[model samples]
Target: MYLRLMYLSSLINIILSFNITDYLYRYEYFDQSETTTTKLESALIKFQEFYNLQVDGTLNNDTIELMSRPRCGVSENPSEFYTYGNKWTKNQLFWYFAMADATMLKIANRVFDIWQNYTNLNFIYSIKNPDIIISFSDNIFVHKNNPRCMKGECLFPFDGKSGVLAHAFAPRQNKCIEIHLDKGEDWYIGFNKTPLAQTSLFKVLLHEVGHTLGIKHSSDPTSIMYAFYSENTDHLSKDDIEAIQYLYGKRKESSTTNTSTTTPASTTPATNTTNETNKTKEIKLDLCDIWTNKF
Candidate 1:
């Protein structure tokens, strides 16, 4: 009787701990119809691989911790991995801030400039007939109350302070691209402060701008487009530059304008003046002490 009771207790514990299936389903890792054990394991493995976690196909402590960390509301499934359906056809894209503080707007502009430095795209700030619109919601209920969120325009409703930071829609012809941030999060501008509970507006906006450009979440954790939010990263990684450039060719260089340099399509000696200036810019941006454990 004692042995039977112990076995039953262990089984109960295992069943209770297997709570990640719902998360898997929500993130497009699992289909409702294919919830068999083999399928579940497959989904777990896929998720682990994307996040560079151990591929044991089990809901380990590290996996649970990662899930608990705040991330973008965008789905990390393979179906929409690198680039979403179509890239924007035009080179010049206009953006408008439907809702944002002056600080947020400034940081957003910087983020847009960073992206344009590496891609053949120009982002113009305008309120009239904007291609992309950005806004913030106080909470999930703001969607039901706001008219702009109606007619399939709303993103997955944000989950309070720290679960989901923000989300953005990919480019669609004639449809305004939307990027919604969670106002509940404590947003900050600079990277000088360490161990801050605040989310970096620059990082989040940079990631969402990638989405608006029709680039999807990157599996590389070092990339700004990584689904999960981390303060450790400030600039774009090689994967991020490659993914964006793949969609919109490299920015055309002008003799008078200094622009950020990206990874070349082929290996070349870094002896050019342009490359030296870009290297200097990157070094300046890395002056902050990155608090990796905060996330």
Candidate 2:
């Protein structure tokens, strides 16, 4: 009877802890009843899912071990990774623009899901506004007379066809990113045949967005940010979240000191009210599309 009661109590605690790591900061006072074998298994799964750890239900030494540890795995890598050419292939050229197909939507959702699990940061996506945009010029190698690609501030890291695929601006810009659109179609993956595992342009673009958002490559092998992207690659690692959040700052109470942008909020005091009201209507483009389009 005592064992059954204990089991019952643990079951209640387990159900209540559908989201274990969400309360990571409050684990100090978490009810002990919630730490039973079954309950622990459930919580551990949450932990595993969040970190992409082994998902075995059994709370073996590996699982039991990380639970007691503070999460410092977020900030391991900081370098960028890219394709060898830094230029797009034939496949991308045939398509002109990388359309938002099922694969793109799937990748976007996967990005959201991973971020939701790892961080508390806000990702404001727009319905009418594509998450990214691309810019292509006719000239190659020189920005001097190349299409819009040469215009000062056209987009960083892309000098027309200068071997730089595309450059995603820092997220703080809150605007569209640039990609060289006219690349070969051969660079793209199957015509929507398989899942997101393969090393397609869609996959590369997805990974690059992580870089633009401040996620550095990970030492962990399973990560999308790993040095060499592959077909079977999974989502971001806990390290990826750590790196990204570090760049954008973490979940903290709102403060005025850090709230303001470089241009003071009072710059256009007379027109400020009008601009603020109009801000809602402005649609921002996505970084992935812009950068990948160039490449």
Candidate 3:
């Protein structure tokens, strides 16, 4: 597979949470081939399309930088991620979403977008039963209604120094995904934070969203899900993109989601032109894929 995204060398220091050597372990007994690499390349292109960037897999740092900008909603504070306490009155997961800020809305859209890219999965967020919930104050957050982690994970989206950016629960067997909103209190919904002279909110959101969609962290430094968040880095690495498309490509049984009479279902069709010929059919994409880059 051709690594389409552009790549730029960086002086930024990154610490790895997961060892790169593990991939070598997977590669040792695992079948590694251009076919797999191409699959990875395909995933990257899907993400590029989601972010409205050029469909290149070269890990272009410039493109990643551009990707950090607002795609879903504009922010007043515009910084990377922040840490704030999740001071909520109720224990219900939906309470956090009720108080979602512009940053949170953008993050939600990004999450939806990644899921939308995989046509076969056809997963959509039910505003009637939204899959993600967020409790944000500064960078720390508590989430619930998670498919896997049941009680939800306690996390920080942007704890300074790239120590801990964020985390997410896996897609549940019910075929739904649970993503929690987390960031620092000082972190801007946009890029207003002091450290983000150059960085992206959407970039981090995209990465976390990828995790919700089943993308594991990648060894490719350029990948959005790389263990470390780099300064001025945005956009999914070629490997990151490939990982998503391939994983979600399998068709799960059709699932119908109920929408609130007030909110109504958000029916976003897929953007994969390859499937356009089957006009009578529908392809589901992550809401992030359909609308984030526009914001």
TM-score of candidate 1 against the unseen true structure: 0.75
- Per-model TM-score, in order, reads 0.75, 0.36, 0.43
lDDT (C-alpha) at residue 77 in model 2: 18
lDDT of 1 by residue, 1-295 (tens): 8746644554555456546777788788989687999999999898988888999998876676677677898887765648877988888787766534344455566788888988888877654567787767655423322223334335478766677899988888765667888867766644344234667767888898898998888888899998888878778999999989899899888521422222112112111111112221111122122122110
* Backbone collisions counted per model: 0, 26, 65
Backbone-clash count (model 3)? 65
Give the 10-residue window scoring lowest on summed lDDT in candidate 3: 270-279
CA lDDT scores, all candidates in order: 0.69, 0.38, 0.39
Best by TM-score: 1
Arrange candidates by lDDT, highest first: which order?
Answer: 1, 3, 2
Instruction: Rank the models by TM-score, top first.
Output: 1, 3, 2
Candidate 3, superposed: residue stretches over 4 Å from native? 1-98, 122-125, 137-142, 145-149, 152-162, 175-185, 191-199, 250-295
When 1 and 2 are scored with TM-score, the better candidate is 1
Which pairs clash in model 1?
none
lDDT of 2 by residue, 1-295 (tens): 8746644554554455434433332322124445666665665555455445688865554544344322211222122232111222111111112334333333344444454444444433332233334223332422322232224534222222112233343232323333332231223332243332112545455555565455544546566665333555656666666665554445445421221111111111110011102111223355553442342
Stretch of 10 with least lDDT, candidate 1 = 267-276
Angstrom error of the Cα, residue 197, model 3: value is 6.1
